[model samples]
Target: MEKDFKEYITPPVMLVVLLLAISLIFVFPVLNMIILGAILAYGIRPIARIIQSKLKFESISIILAMIAVLVPLILLIAYIVSVVSGVLTDFLASNPNFDINAVLTQASVYVPQLSPDNISTTIGDIAKYVANYLVGKIGSIANISLDLFILICSVFYFVKDGDKCYNFIKSFVPDDHIEFFDKTVESVENVLKSIFYGHFLTSVIIGIFGAIGYTLLGYPYGIFLGVITGILQLIPIFGPWPIYWALAINDAFNGNYPRVAVVLLFGFFLSWVDMYIRPAISSHHADIHPLILLVGFLAGPLVYGIVGFIVGPLILGITYVVLDSFRKELTESK
Candidate 1:
């Protein structure tokens, strides 16, 4: 016991602690990018592996997989941002507060850099920064550069060496704690799937349905409205309700009472479907509480910027599962 205490306060350990603190201080700024990259790599790995199976070059496969996954995503998000900015610009001049109908008509959308989707995230506050960044109003090009570099590198490395990384971490675990560790890892995986299904996948499903419904109703930008609804769905607290309600309000103001009723009923259906769909998709997973994810979505951006939308929820989910795992282990022991 004396020897253990002596080692605990030893100079070498103290130095190690000091170095870790210093390293963390340096890492803290770019840490979110690294973390987000790992999260993205989780999805990218399988694609890379499948591509690799067809070709002998692992690096080429990973690159191709990355290009396949990221190029469309980049193009889609770029279009959304470009379209939203154009709408905001054109409408802000006519209506200082910005016209909602203009937004519905002209804007395309969703997610991180972005979101409020992609695990992606935000629409409510997306305008605040996205417009600025997209329009070349941002001051720190170097910071953006660093963030992209770290994100891409981290994704590539994580996809390539994730198993090795896991094994390395596992080596440090005590034998008695091995089972607990494994369970906790499994739980973490479940939590990721839960978020992916509960938020991301649900958002996609809702968006498609919203697009189809809005178009059928003959709204000018029906498809875009559906896309926006899907983004709202990603928000958890808000859903497809806002889009329909907005349209209903617009209809009511224009003396289109019958259409308002129709849209509202459609809105109700959108909200109603969510109840069944979100749970049904997430049923096979960890079933993380909504509060955790909500806090994550709202708070993540504050700490990690837009990427935090997904990161916040995921990190919180991991924490909850770990604690839950610990609780179960402690209970079983008693």
Candidate 2:
């Protein structure tokens, strides 16, 4: 009886528990990176495979597919850096000699009984403290560089041996729930594809209009601001609003009313794109509940910073899909 019980656990239950404990231990470092890497690989693999199938050259296909993914990212970063530098130079050149205290005093008009003097002093103090605190912060750039290097190493390994690693890891799941496990994976993939594709297309469309409008109006950082505004459009609600408002406020402070007016008009048009165009396009890929997506979006930054933006939603979507699958499976089995 004792031997039979031991053998029973050995066949599956013991293996399951052991794997679960290991997964829990390295969940963040290894599993998280692997999952992210797999999703990235999955997204591009089809294109690579298509090329290989047509040309019978797997190596060339892989190289082309990698270039397609990597080159745009490098260019995008370079563009951002260049634009930011230009904007900073432009801002410094424009000498706006306005009293910050006076602006605060004027703002207290609608909300009477507030002391503008105290408010101005407090604002000035906080601003000084913030500047000092930022100066005191050390080695953030170095830390970021190190993290990027680590991520690149992980990504390379993942792309190379991802399938074998995934299979080995996934093997721990009980045979009974294997189908459910597969469903969870598909759900995650679907969510990622939906988010990436929807955001990319929408941003491109917005960038086209934004750039054209900014260029015609002769905004100093037209191309830069346009691209930044379009990228920011990925965020919900107050997405493009920040860039538009920043440009407007910067122009206002510089006494450039014409520039402000042009940017404001551009902002209004962009809102229409965000409110109407995105939902229509995204629905075709995935019928995500706006509320759920909104919650995930807010939670994403809190939990995992930038990576969490996509990872959070993917996690939620997979959980929801897996639970649904389990329930359906149980019902049919019953």
Candidate 3:
């Protein structure tokens, strides 16, 4: 009886230890990587598959596909990083002796209804009161570098092992449900592909028009601003309007009165394109309501950051299809 008790206890204890070891060694990192890699893979998997089918070369196809996809992304990220870094560096170099109180006092007096007589004295007093209010910039170079490295590594692993992943997931589904699951996943994949491709094409159109309009209007950094505006336009709801409006306001502030009208007109055109064109494109691609797509866009970012834009909508689409299928089945049976 003592031997039997010892044997059972040892097995249970060993099992617990093994489970703990597996959790520490395997579960945590994989879970984190899955979230990261799945998003990257979802975006690029179509292109990779196309390359495989058309090019008929496995390793070369994937490599070329990665280069085609990642090179522009890397370049874009570098450009943004450079621009942000330059801004930060300029700020650091300026080392401004900010007189916050004086500015506030002057600002208050400049307002339409404020007293003029109290302006200088108020400004001086406020300046003296808030002399120590200052902030220093923290450089983001290290963090950006680390993030880029992780993203690249994750993308590589994701592309390499994606098939294995599909098989692993497929293994879990019951035999009868397998086809349904496959079809659902395919539908989700198609939705994601459509959204991405449509958005990309629309952005290109907007970016080109923006570049031309801004350049014609003689705005500084028009091309850069246009590209930025175009990308921002991909965001749901708020979209590109804010950026163009901000640019227009900057022009007004800087006394470029003539260009302000042109800028405003440009923004309006872009907004029009977004309103009219995007919905049509989305409809063509997804066969879903534009309103629902908009909701997906809004919810996607909230749920999954950049990736959520595609993933969230795909999820909603799949669920809609599945529920509709069930509803049809029930009606038929009845």
Q: Which candidate number maximizes lDDT?
A: 1
Candidate 1 to truth, TM: 0.81
lDDT of 2 by residue, 103-171 (tens): 666777855544577776778999999988677555366655555565555555555566888799699
After superposition, which runs of candidate 2 have C-alpha atoms over 4 Å from their true positions?
A: 1-8, 50-64, 91-150, 157-185, 246-265, 330-334
Better of 2 and 3 by lDDT: 2
Q: Rank the candidates by lDDT, best first.
A: 1, 2, 3
Worst 10 residues of 1 by lDDT: 111-120
Q: Which residue runs does candidate 3 get wrong by more than 4 Å?
A: 1-36, 49-57, 84-105, 110-179, 254-258, 290-310
Checking candidate 3 for backbone clashes, the offending pairs are none
Tens-place lDDT per residue, model 3, 65-146, is 7788879989987887887788778876786775655666677666833444465567778887666332111255564466
Residue-level lDDT tens digits of model 1 in 54-142: 99788999889889988987886786787788777877787787545444434335212322132123453677577777767367778
